[model samples]
Target: MANEHYAKFIEEAFVKPIRSVLIIDDDYPTLDEMLELEIIHKNGDLPPKSDKRWHDNPGRIKSVIDGFRQPQRPLLVDIHDGANVDTKGDAKVAAHLHQSDLLVLDYELDKNRPQDGARSIEILRGLITNDHFNLVVIHTSEDLDMVYREVILGLLGATSDELTEGEQEAVNQLIVEYEDVDENALQALRAAVATDQYLHARLHASTYMRTMGQGQQPYSDFCALADEAGWDNGNRRLVLRKLLADAERPLRARMRNASTAGLKWATSGVRWVKAESVFIAFSSKADHDDLFADLQNALEAWNPAPSRLFMAKLRAEMDEYGVVAQTEALERQHALAHWYARLLRSKGDERRWLIAESVLRHSDQLLNTILRRVEVFATELISSEAVAAGDNIEARCQEHFNVDLSKAAPKKKAEREHNAFVSSKSPQGWHLTTGHVFTMNSEHWICLSPACDLVPGQGATRNADFGDRTPFMAVKLHPVPVDGNHDVNSNLYIFVTLDGEVQKFCFNSQGKEAVSPVWRTLYAERRGLLDKDFGFKISAMGAGSRKLVATIHPAQVVAQLRYEYALNLLQKLGVSMTRIGLDFV
Candidate 1:
């Protein structure tokens, strides 16, 4: 019953107008279908022919060809010679041009000369001067030279086979370049599994794509494939057996017992074409400016805070990881920015509040500066410039709030001793050596070894006597502060590893000594930066050095004096106790 109903509906829906089509394809079935469609739409009557009115009538042609839409202005241009054509042939060609809407012309004419097609095309060019919209298809069976092939065929043809041998070989070589991409993916997956850092797989994917000039193809594909594969079989089960086989015993065992069901998505004809394109576009950027602009626009248009926040996160990511090749990045960034600006114009000021919140939240200096620049313009009416400046604020706020302690002085010896250890001697003997004296918090008490001691008697000792064996004559260094205390104890320890060497350290504690060794070949210098608000300079004692000094800024102390102003504002806003906490989070 349903089948009969559907058949009736299809017949009733698709069988009216039948005659208007100028069926050029030499194929009959398509013509029949067109006629059937015409009949369906025209109430069983055919369209009038020779009236020139059907040429203006609007209708869509369903065919493999896409560039052609209207039959009135056919784009296929034939450059056939007029000399070979008699008046009858000329009339037919003219009829095709005037009635059929398109004239597929032969480029060469045999009656004139060997170069008739090219000459014919040139001569007919006068006929379609204003009709540049008409497509001039230069079709030929002859095998032209490479340059001619490229100019005459390759650019015009939609298929790869249209390219010459050299071009095809070049394309094949390009394909070969990506042949090992799957292997690289496997290796990255294996490494990620070993490290238990699944996110690192993304990095590996990105790196591999960049290396092969494929941008993000391999990485995006891996992610999309993995996502499609699902987690039903456990992530470990989803890993390749070959990769796991070389892994340690436990991982190998996991692979052996893995479920094949998790791989259903992998076999579901999954293609990463779109994802690869996106990756390539993103990774090939010349600079982040345009991306930043787009993000700003999106953020301004985003609502509910979370969306804007998400955009901000994306902006941060792009700024950090976007390809640094300035030309590409800049071009992409500008184009993206322009598009985003248009999008924001469509969305209006609701996104502004979100942008403001995001900017204020970051507390960065550069971002704040940019924000301040646009503050005047951000009030009632917003413009693209304001959005841009606001975005810059969000980008730079972290830097704005950063404290610089590079020039600050070290803690006084008396202060360090008070903070780190309760030890003190009376009169002249109670002196602390000046070697980057500062308070650092540690869970364990620090034992000071006598590299060279001044009037040392015994040394320092831990008062807790909990697992501490190092003997001290006067007092032990309390590295961690007690509860409710503002003082910080010195708990700083530096470890150095040299290339191609193993480091061994021996420590004695409580009548027992232990030795530990670590690989030093991977050692590289890592440094920390002080915030812009931090106000201290750090200097450490080197070998044979007796003293180290740090300078402090008195102005910082004065600035902290005003910290209460902000705190009071928070308290008045009812946010101090409820929302504000000492923890960094």
Candidate 2:
């Protein structure tokens, strides 16, 4: 019955309003399909086929889907193995996820070849990371408490093992459904957690989101809380206890009210969809007065035709597109205009397909560029007096949004900037590829060996004649002091760029003398280094001394450094192959 709670709430809030939904399960909900399609999992990870509840799970979902009325029925997509998600991958799954108003996922996706419902979190996480707003509901006959706990921790970037003893205790205590706290509830929680035997109970997704999540902040503030707790016996447990306790304070009645509010909110999307329908209806059903009224409305909408306005927008909003991109875009506009004209003439499904096709044809960099511009614009805009009058950004926001953004404790500004250039990987990272960063004897270094020299099968042949079977060419990474007042924006720095001016750097300088004062100083020093110590300095690392700290992001090398700068760096290293420095220098 608890597992079936999903059908009742969904039928009431989702089905009636005709809200689009994406359902993910492992079965097609029929005896014939189940008999033919059910593949035995090697581990025997699920209940036996004889179990009525397990066998009839898909039938339950199908019943609710059947309840949905026709004549503008809600868009419903059912995904299972050999269905929407298959060997080709879940691109269609991602599209439906983005378009759907709600997501209904089975907690046990291990019913087929690709095991574990948790794996679906990877797709959901990717979408959320890109700032896609979404809600999710999980339905299963598994222990409800454990399922809820896993979903919360999984989405918020943590796992049960990462939790301290105290956090685990607090979580267990919170899951016990009781109108008021008592020794019995506390004992039940402890027993359930210890034995890993949890009982079924009702659950709600929105309640969890609003309760644990910090709204726009990623996750459920679980990451932030863990950071604050320091994962020690002290704070993590206390904060988690408070967060969970607060979540339980709201009753099931309040949950229903929130669901009601959401149903009201669904009307906005309905109106957006209905906007185009008005014209279609007008063409078919219009009498004399109706045609005249629509004509007046149509004229009003064309105050500055949307097409013309967007065309002039690139000129008016020059800062949004960097000068380089703006100059480059002029050549592409003529072709785009012709395509847009054809798109406008097309109707129905063809137009929608063309829109998707046109968007895909453009480079990802162009979309990413737009996003970067918007971030830059918003960051500046939010800090201004118009958004919030006071100077305290956090305090002002607490007043503005009623939720604190700082609670998420995301990667720091400086660290994120540095990471953009050098993608770091731990000792447990993938294969020892070229460009992997290393530190030995307190000095940073990079692998100068070709990728073939480190890859297992190819590397053996490449280094077969060397002193050590796994010998690698090495290059030193000269450090620029950026610890204190030293400007990270300086051209001397290879990684961290505080002001994002690093992108414009033409190998050494953006020049036009538009650079910061720090760059001017670094520029002269770099010039002097070339003049005095221009010779390439390479070293060899024998088999024993190859400990690595992190690996560099090659995409940065491909996108940003695959230029004359790379050629210059390569040429210097090439010319001095005859001479080299000491091991791990």
Which predicted model would earn the best TM-score?
Answer: 2
Predicted model with the maximum lDDT: 2
- Cα RMSDs of all predictions? 27.2, 19.3
Per-residue alpha-carbon lDDT of candidate 1 for residues 1-585, written as tens digits (9 for 90 to 100) = 012222222222111111111222111123344567688777966554432222342221122122232364233322222443441234444444443322333333343344334433332322333332121222232332221222221111121113446644543443244344443544455453442222122223334324222314323443443444342223322232222233333422212122211110010111100111010001001222122122222212211122222333333333333443223334556555664565465432224333443344433433443343234323322243244446564332223223222322222322333422222221111222212112222111111212133112212243223122222111112222222223122112111121222111111121111211110111000111123442222232233456644322121100110222223222322321244336665
Which portions of model 2 miss their true places by more than 4 Å?
Answer: 1-20, 23-101, 105-135, 139-147, 150-386, 394-476, 479-490, 494-585
Against the hidden reference, what TM-scores do the models get? 0.16, 0.29
For model 1, the superposed segments whose C-alpha errors exceed 4 Å read 1-241, 244-369, 374-585
Enumerate clash totals for all models, in the order shown: 70, 0
Output the TM-score of candidate 2: 0.29
